[model samples]
Target: MEEAKGFVRRVLLLKFKAETAPNHVERLIKDYSNLVNLVESLKTWHMGKDANIKNLHEGFTHVVELTFEDDEGEAAYSAHPAHLEFHERAWPHVKKMVVIDYKPTSFHT
Candidate 1:
């Protein structure tokens, strides 16, 4: 959707360590959720495991989405102390990750 102001969307795909525990993975998601709680600039947060319908998943098991109100908001998130903490704690458990960002070009309604 196009906004009169502005908006940003972040898509994150994650592949966890091969032997990572299920409970540890769950904690990672929970801690990630806390980033949205602590960052005032974050507009929305969502995440889930891959469906594995096809081989395209490429080992990535989880996906996360974040929405921000503007460029400033997104930038703030990158620099946020809480986010930095989460990044440090989460990176070790992640075998790989893909992050893509975009602004909506059109609105459906």
Candidate 2:
């Protein structure tokens, strides 16, 4: 593996509480995605429901991937009001969440 350079990827694995409604989940995704437009440093956002065929997902049912130009961009995004507001609003719906951030790298066989 080798560093791709000048990029940061944030991965969010979320398991919503069983009682959370589908409609609410949809709204959360919408609001979260909107951050990319609201925060200048947020370069990209992608989200999806879990579709893993293997039973390895523990209990997480959704995933969100965020890309930034670099570490500074990601830090700015984290401190941005849009992101803070969204996190405050959405945290209650999540039963469990795992957040991982890393510099993107290439994997070669």
What total of clashing residue pairs does each candidate reach?
A: 0, 0
- Once fitted onto the true fold, the runs of candidate 2 whose alpha carbons sit more than 4 angstroms away are 107-109
Predictions in order: lDDT: 0.91, 0.93
Kindly provide the TM-score of model 1 when superposed on the true structure, using C-alpha atoms: 0.90
- Write one digit per residue (lDDT tens) for candidate 1, span 24-93: 9999899999888899999899998889777789898899999998899999999999999999998999
Error of 2 at 62 (Å): 0.6
**Candidate 2, residues 48-67: lDDT per residue as tens digits?**
88888998889898899999
Candidate 1, superposed: residue stretches over 4 Å from native: 1-4, 107-109
Give the best candidate by TM-score: 2
Estimate the TM-score for candidate 2. Answer: 0.92
